[model samples]
Target: MKNKHLFLFILLFVGLVFILSTTYTVLAEKDRRYYENTGEVVWEIDTKEKVVALTFDDGPHPKHTGEILDLLAKYNAKATFFVVGENIEKAPDILLRQYNEGHDIANHTYTHPIKTTIPKLEAELKKTNDLIYSITGHYPELFRPVEGQYTDEMIESVVKQGYKVVMWSWHLDTEDWKDPGVHRIVKTVLKGTEPGNVILFHDGGSNRSQTVKALEKILPELQKQGYKFVTITELLYMNNENEK
Candidate 1:
């Protein structure tokens, strides 16, 4: 009787473990699939072309933004700048220069708010859109949520405002926001980048000297690899073409 009871307890424990493991795996897989789908928020493009989109956020910084622009010019590379509305207000000419330089200017919200109501989020996006339009005479068709933090309601709001939500490839995040050393930033980006990647960087936040240094190394290396830098719109267009 004792042996039978022990055997039954062990069997039940094993069964419970299997059930829990299976449930965890299924949930994880579902989350992965949800993020990978390109119908709405695009993470990366599907293509054979050696092209990548270099995107800067929280920008129009008084100094860093210009430095980044100069670097892009040096390489004759184009990029997409997701500018904050308040920053644009401070430096309208910089935003205008970004437009004049032929780089894509997109909306990153009027203010960088992490948590807010759907109505507030919508207003933020609209304000930014109007601001950019006021300067460039064109409203941005692309919107990247502040900090890539978005709830379904936030996404729906942006979509209703007639913008495509953009996200970067997970592996391509340089973590430059942390102000990690320049070498690390360069290594992280160059090592993780592949064809059709959307590489993320920042141009507006606290001292971006390290980011600038990393770019010095990153651009030449990537160009040497034959990877052409294009704006996010071009990358998306390439993706759409490949799908067809």
Candidate 2:
């Protein structure tokens, strides 16, 4: 009797271990699958297509936005600009120019608030979407949160509004919002350059003179390496002509 009880306890222990391990694997796999597909959010695409996305945030600045646009035009490069709604009102012409030139005009927010409640978050998104629609005929499909700060509920709200939460590549962030030296900004890009990277820059929210200066080195050097600068959307769906 004693031997039988011990055998039964051992079998039950093994069964419990199996159940727990299986559950964890399934949960981990679900998470990995969620991130791999562009379901409702994106940090960076997983590919080796020699196509890098240049995304500018907090933009539509009068001077800096114009300078970045000019540089993009000269290089025959395209980029995505995450514009704030209040800044759009200030420089609607710059916003219009972004649209006319075939760049992506995504919503950053109306006021660029961080870590706010869900209701306030929705309001910010709606006001920005309305203003962007007023300026441009199309509603932006992409919305980037300020500093990429968002809760799961916030993401759910955004998804219901038909917007994708966009984040930048951790490897490619230059911290240029601090006005880091132009050389550091350029070096960060040079070191972290990879296929399917989303390089982050800003045209508003602070002095972006260093960002402007770094681009002079970045745009040309990346182009020389045979990597095409594309908008974030293009990077997401790009698979046709991937360069090895």
Candidate 3:
């Protein structure tokens, strides 16, 4: 009777271990699947095709936005601009010019907050989307967090809002906010650019003399490299089509 009771106890212990192990595996598998389907927290699409996306952040600055648009037009390239909501309201003409010029305008958030808290993040994003739609008569399919700051919940919330989170694969750091020289901006972007790269730049906020200057050189140089610039939406669509 003692031996039978001991065996029964041993069986119970093994059964409990098996149940726990199975439960863990099931949960882990579900998490993995969720991440696979929804964890695309990227600023740029990753592909090997000889296409580059030039995405400017915090833009529609008065003088610089026009200069950049002219440069893009000269090169016959269509890049993406992640514009701020307040800036859009301030410079609706610049936003209209961006849309009219065939550049893809994306949301960079309403107030350009650091996204440290959930409520602030949601507010920033929603307000930006609303402003963009109000000005452009269209909804943006892409969004970039201010300073690329985000939490997992923030990312999930953005995805739920139906905007793909865009983060740069390359950092040219035009540092245009500091009014760096045009040559400095040009050299930084030219050196860092690669096929399928998403180059980060800026057009708004402060004196963007450097960005304006850099574009004059950067545009011609990129064209010479046979790099075709496309908008974020075009690139993402191309990527999705290629997957099939």
TM-score of each: 0.85, 0.83, 0.80
Q: Please list the residue runs of candidate 1 whose C-alpha ends up more than 4 Å from where it truly belongs after superposition.
A: 1-38
TM-score of 1: 0.85
Whose lDDT is greatest here? 1
For model 1, how does the per-residue alpha-carbon lDDT over 54-132 read when each residue is reduced to its tens digit?
9999988989999999999999999999999999998999999999999999988888887678788778988888899
RMSD of 1: 6.7
The Cα local distance difference test for each model comes to 0.85, 0.84, 0.77
Worst 10 residues of 2 by lDDT: 24-33
lDDT of residue 199 for candidate 1 = 93
Where model 3 places Cα greater than 4 Å from the true spot, the runs are 1-39, 46-48
Ranking by lDDT: 1, 2, 3
What is the per-residue lDDT of model 3 for residues 17-68, given as tens digits with 9 covering 90 to 100?
9866434223223343354356455545557776888889887787888888
Alpha carbon lDDT at 224, candidate 2: 93
- Whichever of 1 and 3 has more lDDT, that candidate is 1
Q: Summing lDDT over every window of 10 consecutive residues in candidate 3, give the lowest-scoring window.
A: 24-33
Task: For model 3, state the Cα shift of residue 170 in Å.
Answer: 3.6
Stretches off by above 4 angstroms in model 2 are 1-33, 239-244
